[model samples]
Structures are given as C-alpha cells and as structure tokens.
Target: MSGSRNPRTAVVTGASTGIGEEYARKLAERGYALVLVARRAEAIERLAAELSERHGIDARTLPADLTDDADLAQVEERLSADGTGDDAPIDLLINNAGRGEGGTFTKMDPDTIDAMLSLNVRAVLRLARAVLPAQIARREAGEHGAPLGVINVASVAGELTVNPHGSVYGGSKKFVTLWSESVALEVAKHGVHVTVVLPGYVRTDMTRDVQDKGLPDFAWIPKERIVRDSLRAWAGGRTKVVPGAQYKAADNLLRVIPRSVFKSVARRFG
Candidate 1:
C-alpha cells in the first residue's frame, strides 16, 4: 500500500529483483517517484508499471548493464538530470547493482572478476559522483529532508575474512563500505547522508544458486527485511548498517580479529 504523496524521487539500480526490488517497493510505498535501473528492459518496465499503478507515483525504467561503460554512463547521466531543475529532485539513490561471483580469489575467471569490479565498485562510485552535487544543492536550499542520501548495498563479506569463496567480492564491497563512510563524513556538514548497508545471507535468486557458499538456512533472512532495515538505518542517520542480528554480531567479531588469524580460519573452515 502507498503512503501520502511525496514530491521527492529516488533512483534505484538493480531494481528489477532481489533487494533492489524491495527498495523500489518500499520507496514507492513512501510515495517517491522512482527511476528503476536494471539489465532487463522488459522486466524493469513491468515493475515500473506495477509500482506506478499501485502507488500512484511515477516509475520509469532504464535498462542498462552496470558493467558496460556506456551503459553505466547513461544511468549516471539520467541521475544527474533528474537530480536538478524542474522534476522532483532525486532525493535518494540506492546503489544496489552488484555481481556475486562464485570461487576463490585465485580461481575466479578474469572476465568475471572484471565484471564484478565494474558493477560492484566503479558504477556505484560514478553514479554517486554524478548525483551528489544536485542532492547536496537541494538539501542546502532548506529542503525538509535536509540531506539527500545514497545507500550503498554492501555485504557482510566486506568486513570478514571471506576468502576461498568470496575474496574478490568481499574486497569490492570493502571498497564500497569504506567509500560510503568516507563520503558520508565529507558531506555530513552539508547534511548529505551516505549509508553502506552490510547484509548477511539474503534469500534472493542469486543466493539460491550459491547455497553451498557457507550460508546456512538459519542465517538466511528474507530480502524484504534486509531492505526495510537498511532504509530505517539510513534515514535514522547511520553511516553503516548491518541488517541481521547474527551478522551484526559477526561484524563486531571481525573487528578485533587479526588478518593472519582470519586467513587461517577462512582456509580451514570457510
């Protein structure tokens, strides 16, 4: 169900499915006009129409593979455009496009590694850079929300010694987590927020295929809860958010563990 109409808008990458889809749903529920980005044009357009019809809000689809340089640039350009001038300024950006590749850092295919970096890291930074100027400008103009923000859908793997299975993936997310925190501080004085959400095992199509990657049934949380918890933390001014109580504890544990020990543990059990 939709909430009262809001003049604000949001751009959500990877909005066709999984956590990204949930973000689209929840943001639409709160009345934000949406720009949904994903690789499948038909899929995203259908989602857009459903959201628009359900919520009485604008929902447009921009289909692009985040790994393609040209495609990535288009998404950024659209964000910059929607973030300024007459249309409802893009009040939120959910940088949720990512690739979860299987295999250890060493055994991973080079092409897959490259694709992961392009989508999981480069696209996120480029898109954020494009939209932030406008988001900050609007907030400084005494916008009621004060700070327009970007939510980077990072992973719990970012903070762990997640090798063997997800080393490169974890490394890329580590970049996202740190980058969000750094930019979050840089924009804090201007009331612009940046949140990096580290979610644990979430039951999405991606995870279903990677069930043997050490995620247990008990640890798996539904996709909806992850998105909901993340939005709450972001809106409540948190710079970093871990959605699950179990993952929250794990994140804390990783904080004090030494790199050597982490590596040892990863090799033996993970």
Candidate 2:
C-alpha cells in the first residue's frame, strides 16, 4: 500500500471489512499481490498478515482515509511512474470505499452530507482517474493485454426510485453506477474492464445496525453471497453485476416502471 509492488498488484480500498475484505481474500486465492487500504491500520495489517500466511501473496496495508487529499496522493503516487519508467501499474482497482447515511435531507447534518459525498463520489472517481493512464499505457504496449478490472461497489438504492430517508445516499450510488458504465465502454477496447456492483442490503456492521433499528426484511441481504457473486462477475468480464435474485427482479421492474409510480411503490416498500 505505501510502497509499490509488482505490476500484477490489486488495490482494494476499504479492505478492512465487508465485501472489500472478501475481495481481497479471493484475489489472494487467485495469486495476486494486494494493496489493502482502509482507515484502520491494525485491522488491515492483521488481514494482510493472514492473507500472506495463507496464500503466500504480498499484501501491504495502507492506512489512510480516502477523503484526505494527502492520503489519496500517496496512493496515486505509488501507482504512477515517470514517463521514462513504467514499473508499477495497478492491474486491478476496487473502489469499494463508501458509506451510507440515512435521514431526511433537511435534517441531515451539512458536514455529514459533505463528507459522505466527498468519500463516496469524489474519492471513487479520483482514484480511478489516477490509475487509468497507467492501465491505458500498458494496454497500448500490448503486454499480454492482461485484463485490468475495476470494480465499483454501488448499491441497490442506485437503481431504485428515491427513498425519503435514503435520497442522498441513493443519488451518490446512482452516480457511481452510471459513471462506471460509461467509463467501462470507454476502456473496454483498451483491455480494461470496469464493473459497478449494485449490492442490495448486504449484511455488514452497517446493515446490522440498520436492521436492529427495524428496517424491513426485503432490505437485508447476505454479504457472503454478494461477495461470491460479485467476484464471479468480475472475473467473467461483467460490466454490472447486481447481487441477489430479489434485487435483480427489483432492478428489472424499475427499468420499465414510470418514475412517479415507482416512487410511490418504493416508499411503501421501504
């Protein structure tokens, strides 16, 4: 994470827990060196050690908040090289560092909204931009045309009509989903693959709290299955993979329904 590693390295943000942790583990299983990043240094370092012991792969823990410009620059610098040298290109980048905040828009704290948007949207795109030039360069060199996969973890809320309490969170994820799709098309011919993973209520510490507060059953999904399905989709070159059958069905429905009617149904269901 701090220092550069092999060109086959995979950088996974928010790698301390949830789906990000699963992605790190699975990628290690597939023999990729990892740059595991998260706010908590100890947790990510422990995970790195565990992964190294189990898979014999290199795992570096970079403890930095993605919202910080300095921290983001550290990552960007490690992934970039001068025009004279092409040494450390990130083969896979997983932009999985984001959060969800719920409440009425007017009642929400302005600072919280700003921070959420900064981390969820700004950091996601900036990180992608920092690494893309190197990826494109590698593709142009015809170096195996080895796959460069970028997985953006969006949300089921991105595909649904706005929920009163989840409006801002939903809007941010919708940005991720749309931006990923457009960028995937831009990079596909260059041998770079991009996927936006729209997960539906994955069971993490975050969802546990939401459920404890009595959110509806339709809103909770198992995290393991989400990870499994997403890893499969990422490996198979899928541009967008929505986890869970219910979420898939719901997405398909939202596709055809009128926005006004969909909004009404979503409010009642949520």
Candidate 3:
C-alpha cells in the first residue's frame, strides 16, 4: 500500500490519541490523506490542523463516538462513499476505537459491557464491512492501483487463557483477532488485506492506570512502534502482528502453556 500510485486515503477511528494518533501521523508521513475520527471534536480538529501543516496532506476530522448508532452510521457512510472528484477512495482503515473495563464479567456494569461490545466488536466489524466491497470491486475490475487494507488494533490480553480482571475486554479483543484473521482469508484473493495488531502495555491514556501500577519497562511498547509494525505487516500482506519482542515471546509462551496452568494461576491471582 505504501508508495503506490493511487491517491491513498485512510479512515482511522480513535485518531485523537495513543495508537490511533500514531497511525495518523505515520500514514500522513507516508503521504496518505486522512479522515481522523474520534469523540473529541476539538482534539481531532487540532490534530488535523497539525498533521496537515506538518505533512501537507489532506487531513480531515470526523468527530463521532462509535458506540452511538447515529455516529457510527455516519462513519460507515463515509467509508462506503464513492471516490469521485476530490473525494478519494479510502484505501485503508484503522479500527482502533475501543474501550476496556478491568473487572470480572459478573462484577462489570451492564452498560459498560454493552459499550465495550459495541465499540470493540460491532464497530470494528461494521467499519471493515463498509470499506471492503468497493476495494474488492476495484481489484476485480483489474485496477491495480494502491492496495486496499484494514488494520485492527487488538490486545495481548485477548491471547491469555484466563483474564479474570479483564475478561470482557479480553473476550472482545479475542473476537477482533479471530474475525480479522477470518476476513483476511476471505478477502485475500480479492486484493484486500486485513491485519490484526496485538500490543501489550502501550503508553496511552487507556493504559495510564496500568502504567501507574509499575510493570517492568520491557512489558511496555511505544505507540509509534505498534503503528509502524502494524502498517509494515499490512503492507507485506501478513494477517497478524504482535509488536515488541517481549510480548512476542509472551504470546508464543501463552500458546504453548497449558490452559489448566493458567486457570490455576488465575484462581490464585484473580
């Protein structure tokens, strides 16, 4: 997708901060016109101005809370819109808007659970669905321009066998991981790419509480690295990317560890 001939545009949810902000900067650096989406209108507008000034790219702001049906539908409509005249086709989508609550499922509030499901599951699925059909059609018609792709931001928490404190968050991300890989397989032949990114303890507002908990330095990954690695993976036509070597090793260990062992550990620590 990088360095391709077509005028590339990307719609990035949660683009006001953290991983999503990093993605917007990196993509702008790569010459992609951006539609930055987030709930905070002021923040995204500020970012759009900064990115536009710095990169000289067309950076537009779309302030929408993805959990709201009306707002989410607006974003979906933008993704599904045709590229006519100045409105270029969105060649990339970054599904990065999500929320997580740390608690057992039974103890979590009903509204919180619904919000998590709506943003992490429903929003991701719908946004991807919105962007794919046009991409597939362009490919089938033999327009070999810039590649069309979607990058989903999941978490290492999803890969854990037992996450008592974040069961709902982990489960939501697990859905993202599974669904992204499945869609990657389904869309590959049509020249569309889907890549899921799993990160551990990134330095973001979302992880500020965990950062305050004093985890080892090695456990944390920079948001820039996550965006960089994810885009590289997507450009290379890879299905999944786990950023940070420590997390990569941990992901490998988790896959091999016994579920019974994790269950015992969860019982002791949960």
Candidate 4:
C-alpha cells in the first residue's frame, strides 16, 4: 500500500505499548500484515487481534524478551524467513523496545544499565542486521518499492546537546542514532531505507513517571505526533527524525555548538 509495489509485512518490536503499539496500529491500517514482538504476550496478542479485526489484515504476535539470547534468536529467525507464496516478506522493522535507567551514573544499578543497553542498543542493531538481507534482496528483485525501511527509535537525549537527566541511557541512544545513519548510507543504493527516530518526551507508559518527576508539559510531544512524523520521515528515507518542533530546534542548536559549550550548559543547568 504505502508506495510499495505489493502489500507488505512488518515486524514491530516493543509492540505491547507506546510508540511501538501505535506503529503497529498505523502500519496495519496501511495494509501491512504484522508480526508484533513484545515480552508481554497477552497485551500484544490482544492488540494484534484488535488490529486484525479493525483493518482486515493478519496480525500475529511473538512474545520474547530480547535480552535473552534464545528469545532474541527466535525474532531473528522470524525476520529471516520470507513466507511462502502470496505471503509478504518483511518490509518494515521498527526497533522500539528500550528501557530508561534513570539517575546519576554512580547511583544507577549495574544490572539495570546492562539491561537497558542489551535492549536499546544490542537488540536494535541485531534486528536491523537480521532484516536487511531479505529487504535488500526484495529491492534488487524489484519486488518492493523505494525504501523498504527500518525505524530505530532513538531519543533526543542522544544528540550532542545538553540533557540534564541524560547519562548511561544517553550513551546507548547515541549509538543507535549513529549506527542507523551509517547503515542507511550503505544500504541506500540497494533501496533499503533506515531512519533513527530521535523523539523527545512522549506520552507513553514508559514516560509516565518522567511526567510526574517535574518534566514540563512543554517538553512533551504526544504519541500521535511522534508516529505521524516518524512514518513521514521513514517514507522520505530520512536518516533521522526529530518529531517535535522544539526537539527539531534543539537538534539544530546542538549541531552548531561545540561539545564544550553544551557541556557547560548541562553542568550549569543541572
């Protein structure tokens, strides 16, 4: 549907809630048969059923903890498979599962930080690796349209700009942003698009506490805006997307300032 020569299939990670769920919903609407991956089976299954019924598309769920090697492998295997006749090969991969390990670097628990890195960085990279071969093949075969894509959900905290609360989590996201853009360049010739979405705070289950922790309302971009902009950017084959206008300005500001200047601002603000 979405400019693809044929109907597409998508695998959306972290599909149980938040931006991932919205991606699943919107993709189904765009005529993608979906495979929703999340640790919580019931939530994702319910969502899949709802989407299938509403959109008249097949939606399946794969419940897996991406941090577990075996569980993660299952997702990789699924992405590797191009289903039998009339079945759509995966045309989109949304790497959205992530955890926020909040607090001062010294105060953060080692295990929590490890879990965050495993999901936010390692899983994202691995999943993108798993999907690209088939995506590239399909593009070369002339079976898909411009930019069969991957969307890695990075965060604005990863940019060079000052983020008062950003710490270990920021480092992990910076890896995502850079990795996605580099990969995008290598694959663009093959017509495989990759976008690293650098969204600021959004209203999601993950960010509920951040809202209560005195993060101002102005800093929040609603989930709808994030989905809309992310899809738009992905379609345009953008290397990265900063969903909100404020975050766009922040991204622009970060580009011009020296690291030393931003560091001074963070230290002063914190």
Candidate 5:
C-alpha cells in the first residue's frame, strides 16, 4: 500500500544481504524510503547509498547486531519514535534478521544456543512489539493513508517435525509462524497487517552449504521470489505465505502425514 503519503517508509532488518537486501531493493523500487538495519555497517551503508542514488528515495542505514541488548534497544527506540522529528513513522517493518546454529541441542555450545535464540526469537518479538503500537494508533486515529504492517521471515522448517540437528532454529521459527498468525488476527480489526513468510530452501549465503550438497533445482527458491510473494500476500491481507510450489506441496504432505510415520522415516534417512 504505497499511498498518497509523499514517501512511505519501511524499516528492513538484516538488510546487508540475501532476502533482506532483496526486500530493500524491491521496496525501493516501489518508492519507499528505507531504513536499512544490519550489523555490517559498511555493507548496509553501501547498499543504502546505492538504493538512494538509483531510486531517488531516502535510504538510511542503522548498523547494529540485533542480538545485543543495547543494539536491540536502539532499534526499538527508532521504531517507537513519534515521528514528529527527523525520523518518519515506519509504514512497514520487516523482521528478517535471524541466525541458526549447527548440530543437535545437546551438542551446541550453550552460548551459541543463547545467541541464536536472542536473534531469532527475542529480537523478532521485541521489534514487533516496538512497532505495533504506533501502527495501531495511526489506524485508529485515521492518519494512516497507506498500509501499516510487519512481515516476519520464518522458514518452512517451522511447520515440519523438528530437525534433530536444528531443533532450536526450527522451534524459533515455529514461534514466529504461530505468533504472527495470532497477532495478524488481533490487528486486522485495527487495519494493521502481519504476514509471516515461510520459505523453503532458498538461494542465499546461509544456504550455500546446502546448495553445494546438490539438492535438486526445484528444492531451492530464489530470494527474489520469497520477497515478492511475501509483500504481495501482505498487501492482500494474507497472514501466511509459503512461496514455492514444490514447498507448498511438501507443506501439505507434512500436514497430512502422521508424526509417528515421519519420525520412523527420519530414523532411517536422517
């Protein structure tokens, strides 16, 4: 909902690369002024400059690690800003920053597990909380001409039986999926939308190792498609989006198959 507002503003987290970067680019294409958040200062600054120059839109970079308490507080403050000053009210917030640790729950370093949870679960929840009040108020007061929303990037793994080696990561995403659905229901009456994107294997640096494992081409979804489909679904007021055709079929199969049968199959193949 790019509206009569002169320049709609969107805040995109993990904007340094991959799907986050794609969201920034696509939103810029739609003429949204962007606030790009990522830990890599240089990377996000470079991306901001490029997008600003190319699209003739304002693009600012906020460099912070979402897992750090101080850094997370800074972002929350930005999102909670009243927008009477230099900062503009955020029209959209994309919770795209997350991390995953390899190995089973017992084998992962306790600190690593904590960091992953801080990023994937705590940060996502806190940021959404920070942004929602303003959006709800705007809609209630009738000042929001365009859409006010949040799009949380989750994974298809969230809906499937847990991965023995990635239980925490999958669990975190399940929280996002379920939490987003609940929040979407709560905010719909207030004209605020929440969409959770559940993507399968996607072509990104995080999935480079899997890509090298020679999975079939259909198993990998392009990053662009995920962002595109996600934004489309959000604009249309849809709460959940599973972006790939093959993944859609797989998601359906996962739902119908009994857990005992899946566990048995995993014991043999996993």
Candidate 6:
C-alpha cells in the first residue's frame, strides 16, 4: 500500500492501451482496486485480468465511450457508490481517454473537430465534475489522505498551439490544462488535488504515425518514461507535468514568447 490512509479504489479512463493502461497497472500495484474504463471491452478486460493476477487487487472493466453522455452517466453512478467498505473511498480518478484528428483548419471537417473536442475536452470536464464533489466530501469528513486526487492527461501541444495539423487537438488539450489548473486552485481548500499530465509525444499507437512523420527531437519520448514520470508527478500533486526534458524546455519557452511571435512560430509546426 502507498500509505495507510491512501485510497484503494482508483478509476481510470482509456485503459485499453498506452498511458491509461500503464496508469491502471501501476495503480493496482500500489494497492488500488481499479475500475478500468475504455471503449474496447476486451482490451480493458484482459488488462484488468492481468493486473488482478499480478497484484492480487480487485479490478473491474467498464466499457464506456465517454463521448456518449449515457456511458459517462454509468461511470458517475459507479463512483457515487462506495462498493468498498465505508472507510475506503475512491482514492484516485485518472481521466486519460482522448483522441485527435489532424488536418489544416480549413480542411478539417466540422464533425471531426466536434468529435475530437467532445471526447478530448467535454467528456473529461464532465467526468471530473461528476467525481469532484464526492472526493471533496470524503476529504472534509477526514476519510482520505493529503490529496484525494484527479489527474487529467493533457498534452504539451497545449503549451504551444503550434503543431502542424494539430490546431483542434492542441486547443482541446489547452482547454484541459487550463480547467485542471483552475480546478486545482478551487478545490485545494477541500483537499481534493488535481494534476495535469502534459506529455509531448510518446510511443503509443496514437503517435506511431507522428514518429514516421519526422518528428523533431524534442517530441520523441518513450512511453515508459511518460508512465514513470506521470506517476511520480501525480503522487506529488503537481499542477502540471511535462515528461520529456526537451518538451519541458519548450513549454518554458512558450510562457515568455509574445503572442504575435508565438502565432508565427506556431505556423511552422502546423
């Protein structure tokens, strides 16, 4: 167990693959009984089974397309119920399910952009909204530890809305990053911690094509590193995490650049 008072139940979205799967595995090792959510039932089930076998933790797989309001409602319902004993609470919630569609702004279809933002931004915001109150309540009652936390997996693309073919994707992640920071401030008095994981590029299937597309050296980061760094950052209740060193420096640079210069620089990546 991470700590005597730490949460035992952790709910992770997008557990079918990549960072989400890694979060599920590591959380189980730390003694969390996981509720794994993903659109693909078989993948989440297999992952849940493997985690259970390896860690001796209870893991439930829920196939949920968060883009669907109905599916998100089911997750909210599960979180509201303390399936565990009253003393144990839903310790952690990892909102990691997101997708992207790439093209020039003019070339991007409206429906595709809507779907991307819906999954990447709206769904995450809604899920966080659904769970935060319970977490705050548990904290106020002195039932959870230092920070009953939520980690929203944003991207470094949010830091500099500059990537070619990533206008909508970048905007969506920026929205996630901004909202998470605001929520962190709003909920700290209640002891509910919120962290944003802003990764650059990782070796997930989602970025396989980006690798082939001749990514800059800064954007090249391995998935294992992302997983390790994110776990460490979330545990620390960091407001934001930039996994890659190069990307971290780039993120720092974006903070000081003038808007006009930044917009022009953004066009290069686009």
List per-prediction Cα lDDT, in the order shown.
0.83, 0.81, 0.89, 0.86, 0.89, 0.81
Q: Relative to the unseen true structure, what is the C-alpha lDDT of residue 209 in candidate 2, on a scale of 0 to 100?
A: 60
lDDT of 3 by residue, 152-248 (tens): 9999999986773388899999999999999999999998999999998888888778878888888789888999899999988999999999999
Runs in model 6 deviating more than 4 A are 1-7, 82-88, 216-218, 266-270
Q: Candidate 1's error at 84, in angstroms?
A: 5.6
lDDT of 5 at 269: 62
User: The CA-based lDDT of model 3 is what?
Assistant: 0.89
State which candidate, 2 or 4, has the greater TM-score. 4
Give the winner by lDDT: 2 or 3. Answer: 3
- Each candidate's TM vs. the true structure? 0.91, 0.89, 0.95, 0.92, 0.95, 0.91
Q: Could you tell me how far off, in angstroms, the CA of residue 26 lies in candidate 1 after the best superposition?
A: 0.7
Cα lDDT of model 1 by residue, 1-270, tens digit = 122225578999999889999999999998888999999899899999999999999998889998888988888787776423565567789999898886866777899999999889999999999889877766565565434789999898778775433878889999999999999999878878899998888877777666766766778877887888888888888899888788888888788778899788877877
Query: 141-235 in candidate 5: lDDT tens per residue?
Result: 66756778899999998876656328888899999999999999999999999999999888787776777788888888999999999999999
lDDT of 6 by residue, 99-198 (tens): 9777787888888888898899888888888778877766665564445778999988777656643788888898999999999999878777888988
What lDDT tens digits, residue by residue, belong to model 4 across residues 1-270?
A: 234644578899999999999999899889888999999999999999999899999899999999999999999988876655544678789999998866777877889888989999999989988889888877776665545879999998888544544577888999999999999999999888999899898888877777788877889998778888988998998888898889999889888878788778878875
Worst 10 residues of 6 by lDDT: 80-89
- Candidate 1 regions exceeding 4 Å error are 1-5, 82-86, 212-215, 267-270
Model 2 lDDT per residue over 1-270, tens place: 222234367899999998889889888988888889999999999999999999998898889898889998887776654234544467888899887888877888999999989989999998888888777776676555347768899987877676643778989999999999999899888877888889887667666666677777777777677777877787677899988788899888889888888768867875
- In what order do the candidates fall by lDDT, top score first? 5, 3, 4, 1, 2, 6
Model 6 clashing residue pairs (backbone): 164-269, 164-270
Q: Worst ten-residue run, lDDT, model 3?
A: 1-10
Which prediction has more favorable lDDT, 1 or 2?
1
